[model samples]
Structure formats: structure tokens, C-alpha cells
Target: MLMSGSVSLYTDKASLYDVDYLSKDYAVEATFLQQLICNAIQYSPAEKPHLLDVACGTGNHLQFLQEMFVCTGIDLNSSMLAIAKQKIPQAIFQQADMTNFDLAEKFDVIICLFSSLYYLLDTALITRTLQMFVRHLTSNGMIIIEPWLTPDKYEEGKCAVQANQTANVSLTRLSVSRRQRDVALIDMYYTVYDGKNVTSFQDTHAFLLLPHTVLQGIFDSLGYATEVIMKAPFQERGLIVAKAK
Candidate 1:
């Protein structure tokens, strides 16, 4: 059971991040993104396309994406970036914020996955982040995002729990969903057993319930072509794929 305490997942708990999400099928998600890129940039007889992952925590996707593209990842958390850099030394890793980052170079594809966009907390920031991504994209570049649950699909007051363990570490996550207007507040409690000791902490994650219609409008207003694919990695979470008009 989790007790009353708070810890930074981006800092002291960063090493356990991978253990918490050990079951996530990064390979399948990478394959899906690869297919999308292939279809979008068909027959490009140039060097390998450049790919930028914004708010790319720990570079899980980059591990596989690097095989097809020149991968670059940026995250605001230095700890996460450190882990990512150690994992994929061949790829570029930087500490950056998604809303206002300038890489001074263009990418053939820019991705923000794992619903990281929701951390922006509002429609305006979402738009600002998209614009920033657009600025760093090549002429025909595309942006792919795995969005958080939309307003219509969000189930308020829901409880969810997950447990995972390895040879030396055990992790259990219990989360409850609540809402404050457009933001979905997930109160998460985590308890870990590392064979020798036990520890527990709590964290609250607020994600803006970005509606698909609003997302489409934002893309339309920005003069971009967009599509919302409902059948994405997390099923109901959906995906937003966009390209400059």
C-alpha cells in the first residue's frame, strides 16, 4: 500500500521508470510509426531521414526508430535524458521543453508520444507546441502524436491498478481518475519493493482532455493536413498525424 509522500519521477525515481512500464510494446509502436513514415515519404532517394522526438522520455521508441532514421530526442528531465543517452549513444539527446525548443535543424518527422502533449495542460499550449514542431520540420515533414483521452471518452472517477516485477525490483501502481473542467487529474500511488527495502510515493498528473474536434480545428487553423486515427497503440487514446498544407 502507498503512503503519503511525493517523489520526482524525473529525478530520484528515474531509474525505476523503465521498470514501471516494462510491458509497453515499444517495438510494435516503432513499427507503426515506421510504416507511417514510409508511406508519407515514399521513394526519398536521399540520406536517412532525420527524426525528432519531443519530450521523448528515456528514448524507448528511439531504440527501434534509430534503425530506420537518424534519431534525435529531447526531454526536459536531465535524468531521463541521461538514461536515454546511455541507451542510444549514436542518437542525439538534448534537454529541452516541447513548447519552446529550437534545434536549429529540420527533421523529416517529429513525434511526441506517450501522451506527453497533455502535460501542456491547455489548448493554447498544445497549439504553441505544434507550431514549434512545425518550425523544426522539413518542407514535407509530418508530426505524429499519441494523444491523451479526449473529453468524450474520459471516464471520471475511475480506478486502475497495474503491477510489474523483475528479479530484484517489484512495482505496483494504483491510480484514480478525476476531472477539473478540461483537465483529467490522475492521482497515482506507487509502491515499490526492491528485495531489500520497501518504498512508496504519490504523484498527481494532470492531462488536458483535448477533444478531437478541437485538435482538427487547431490543425486546420494552422493550415495543415491532419488525420485522427482512433485505432492507435493505446486504443481509445487515438493518434494525431499532421503535415503542413
Candidate 2:
């Protein structure tokens, strides 16, 4: 199963985490998130959208969202929020948990990107978060979600992948032991060899891997019109878009 710890990755040993290396991953994730947002806006009934980016680490997507909509981000990490505030000065960033967060206003489009929804580690928690998303959505709003690979598609195991540089750092990372059937867990051991020094750090994340049908059923029960698209363009990830019924 995917094991996770509460230890902050951005502690004093931040060099071990390699912000430059992770920034590349964040870029790709932002591209996908933008695409999803664009599609949702095109299909949505709203002219100008209001977006909520749940677990918006460092506000990368939130910055992009601000270009087209009034965007707000919510994340559990204050340091990340501080960085995000620097990046998107006009947008708002709040510290909140996705599974049980409450906001007074609803949004026209709500996005939980980069598999952050999986961090909840429980199917019930995932469901609760979805319900909350629905509750916080305008009547015609859409909820766009991207989840990690299910056990049926990619089994739990170890794999090493190299990242293309988008910043000063280039690195290779190993993903070890992602074996939660109901929830996908991955431990990324990233090794960064800066010109002067070498450092390594691990980021363990857990994601709920509910089947597409299960998610559809949940949305249907909640009076939503849902669509599940596998292998979306611009990336090899799956997407679920749900609109109010």
C-alpha cells in the first residue's frame, strides 16, 4: 500500500527536495489542468467562470486560472501558499483541507489537480470531498478531476523515470511501491545532483483509485451528469467531468 508521512517536504533540507526539478512536473501538470479548465469552460453554460483549485500547491494552476477567471486556491501547506501568493498576487490562497473544507461561496468551475484528491487516503474521504465539491459548485458548474492509475491499468510496483529540464535542475527519480488497491500510493525518491552537491528526498503520496463506474455512480446518485474520459490528449491521464443535473 502507499505509505505517507506528515513530514513537510519543504523543511530546512529543501535542497534535498529539488524545487527546480519539481517545477518541471508542476509545469506539465499545469498544462493538463489548463486544458481541462478550457474544456470545461467551453462546455459550460457560464460566460465568465469562477474557479476553485483545491490543494493548489504553490498556486501554479491558480495563476493560470486567473487569466480567464476569478480564481482562488486552497492548500494545506502554508509555505506553498506563501509561494503561490508571490506568484499570483491578485488571487486568494487559503489554508484548508479538501476532504472537509467549507467555503461560503460556490464556484462556476472547481478543479482538483495533480492527483491531490488521492492524498485523503480513504475512499469515504474521497467521496465526502466529491460531495463537498458538488455542494460548492454553482448549479451549472462543472467539477474536473484527474486521478492516478488504477490497479487494473498499472499495478503496484517500482519504476524509474527521468525528467526533462524546464529549469536549472535535471534529475532522475524512482517511484517505489504503489500498492494500494482502493487507493494509489507512490513514493517518489528524487535524486538531485547539483553542480556542487548531490541530495535525495522522498515524497510519498496516496490517491484513491475508485473505478470509473463507481465515480459515475456516485455522481449520478448526487444528481449529476458525469463523463469519464480515458487517455486524454496532451497527456496520458484520465479525466472525469461532472455537471449538475
Off by over 4 Å in 1: 1-4, 43-46, 232-234
For candidate 1, write residues 1-245 as lDDT tens digits: 43557777867788889988998899988998898889987446577899999988999999999998999999999999999999999999999989999999999999999889889887888899988988898888899988888888899889999999999899999999999988999888899998877889988888988887887888889888898877656476878999888
Best by TM-score: 1
Q: How many residue pairs in model 2 have overlapping backbones? A: 1
Each prediction's whole-model lDDT (CA): 0.88, 0.71
Pull out the clashing pairs in model 1: none
Clashes of 1: 0
lDDT string, candidate 2, 37-149, tens digits: 67655543455578899988777667656767788899887777777888899987899888888888889889886667767766677789899998899887889887666
- Off by more than 4 A, model 2: 1-47, 163-171, 193-196, 231-235
Cα displacement (Å) at residue 27, model 2: 6.5
